[model samples]
Target: MVPDGLALPDDLEGSRNCGLVALSVVARCSYAEAVRAYTDVFRSAYQRHPRKNWKGGTTWSLVVKAMASLGVQHSHTEVTSAVTLQRLAQFTRRDALYLVCTTGHAQVVKNGWVIDQRGAVPVEQHWGRRKRVTAFHAIKED
Candidate 1:
């Protein structure tokens, strides 16, 4: 459950397509379809590729390709500084928020939370203290 004093936006929780693979799956389906497709593909992808190395782990390129395969368009931005929740808030609302961390890990942000292959949690709890965000992709519907 979301923590107290954190008012999640209406659009946030319902549309959380966390994790690189999960985001890719969301891109494959229509917005309506994505609501039900959450994390389904992520589980399958991990089952297929359990390794976490560069070649085996989920990467931004892979996410891009997955989205492309479904005809989704997106724009990428490289973040030079530590990306805070405030910085992320500046982005225009889109279908999903794909973030690449300095550690080379990728996750998705929706509403005010971060959703990954493992599960969903508040952004501050998931990324507020750990890895620095290195880049972001604003996904657009085709």
Candidate 2:
């Protein structure tokens, strides 16, 4: 699903940092840079300690704001339909970037490639097994 030279060359994966890692890949930045950007947005948008709710999983709002902080534009509207990740394209543009959020998880989608803590892979090989995507943040094209 990923084109040549598209996946993060040195992805910094975390046990519970799928959201951060996805942001890192989609923003095309280092994991450290993604963290810093997320921290800035987390402070302003969430107004609470970063990772205070991490155990509960990162919120879609935090992910979207972090993208904006890194200059990756996205649509603020959150589609709450319960669709599987594979069916995401039904609601979002096929060639766009998005922060696809499941009930308690988040991953980055770009041109049908799913980027998570495990790195970029075909959306089918993603955190598999019928992920009912609860939210979708379509990154706007310039």
Candidate 3:
């Protein structure tokens, strides 16, 4: 039997049926949502991946060029190299967590968030309840 909350049609055909179509649509929507949630993180890391920005228009090419650029006469090739695509990728991935944490929207915390019936401001618990102030009494000293 078809369960509630599902839009499966009873008259579904063979493998190429409406149920399958609905299932695919639901799956795609779910996948899209997951992708959207993670895209920012991916973008943050992808931008810095060394491979993404190597000279000669490619990281590998840049590495090769750098290796060859040094005159053969040099006794020892520069053990170090410029930022490669791999390095860039590593850099971005390392920073992605911090970037996302620092870049996202601000979350306001009230004693309690309040919304009016019309969804207007000053909703219940908007600002914590205002307390009354009482005066202190002091006895007169001789």
Question: Which numbered prediction scores highest in TM-score against the true structure?
Answer: 2
Q: List, in order, the clash count of every candidate structure.
A: 1, 0, 7
Q: Judge candidate 3 at residue 57 and give its lDDT.
A: 15
Model 1 TM-score, all chains together: 0.53
Stretches of candidate 3 exceeding 4 Å from the true structure: 1-29, 50-142
Error of 3 at 75 (Å): 55
Residue-by-residue lDDT tens digits, candidate 3, 48-99: 6746531211122221222222211111112133432222223332111110
The ten-residue window of minimal lDDT in model 1 covers 3-12
Clashing residue pairs in candidate 1 (N, C-alpha, C atoms within 3 angstroms): 12-111
By lDDT, the better pick of 2 and 3 is 2
Ranked candidates (TM-score, high to low): 2, 1, 3
Q: For this target, which candidate reaches the highest lDDT against the unseen true structure?
A: 2
Where in model 1 is the C-alpha error above 4 Å? Answer: 1-20, 28-55, 84-96, 99-102, 127-129
Cα displacement (angstroms), candidate 1, residue 105, comes to 1.3
User: Which of the two, 1 or 3, has more lDDT?
Assistant: 1
Q: How much lDDT does each candidate structure score? A: 0.51, 0.69, 0.22
